[model samples]
Target: MTSPSTHHTTITSDPTVPLVRIVREFDAPAEKVFRAHTDPELVTRWLGPRGLEMRVEHYDCRTGGSYRYVQAENGEEYWFHGSFHEVRPSERIVQTFTFEGYPDAVALETLLLEDLGDGRTRLTTTSLVDSFEGRDAFVVSGMEVGVNEGYERLDELLAG
Candidate 1:
């Protein structure tokens, strides 16, 4: 008999900032999963809170490229922009994220995509922030919930 493998995930908070780590297994190949991230059209279809309206103002997803977008929730709009630090096709990507309202609070994000065989893929995202205050603010602001929801939407998009 073989035991089912389980994957572990962790989210930690420090005095200055917090780190969010997520690992999700998807029923798709790595290439397809990777495309969902780098392709603006695909990303726009699934990258925001489920009920919020999102508009991609600018999207240059290659290495050294940048992106900007706005999410409107209940008539309130939030602006976010980021620059791609690195892009490795079908494997990994690194980027810097900043909210327009909180210009000084920048976060570093690393995304890794791994193939789990049998046409399954495991995608892990790690986000590191600058200070504990910023981390607290993010958690209090429901960023975790939003991120998880976004991933769930991605899962559905990929399934389609």
Candidate 2:
């Protein structure tokens, strides 16, 4: 049986710039962690908060590939789409991320995975928006809750 994760997620944002950074450690290998992000089947298992159901429209996790998905809750669906700019398996992924709710604001997201040895991996993500206001809107939108809860669910998946 796997043990519960003891690591805490750290999130930081700069007031002067449109950036949000999140760091979390998982009790799994870097390749496994990266696969969880890239695999559409695994993605729906832990990509968002618990209350919403996710449907993948198209997910191709490779350089120059694009993806779109929707999260539905209470008959309301939220759309998100992005293009993969760079993909380095088990190391990094850079993509463009956009939410249909705020069609005008798009963010560039970079995700990195660091092998921690001892069968652990550290996942770091940075999101840069076009403006500080847009970044603030993301924070104000209860992003932390979704992030933390999602990772917690990821922990469960990893444990399993």
Per-prediction TM-score:
0.87, 0.96
Cα lDDT of candidate 1 equals 0.82
The candidate that wins on lDDT is 2
After TM-score superposition, the amount by which residue 98's alpha carbon in candidate 1 deviates from its true location, in angstroms, is 0.7
lDDT of 1 by residue, 6-120 (tens): 4333445544447766677877899999999998899888886688888899999899999999989888999999999999999999999999999999989999999999998
lDDT of 2 at 105: 93
Residue lDDT tens for model 2, 5-27: 58899999977789999999999
lDDT of each: 0.82, 0.93
* RMSD to native, candidate 2: 1.8
* Clashing pairs for predicted structure model 2, backbone only: none
| Candidate 1 residue runs with Cα over 4 Å from true position | 1-17
Give the lDDT of residue 6 in candidate 1.
Answer: 41
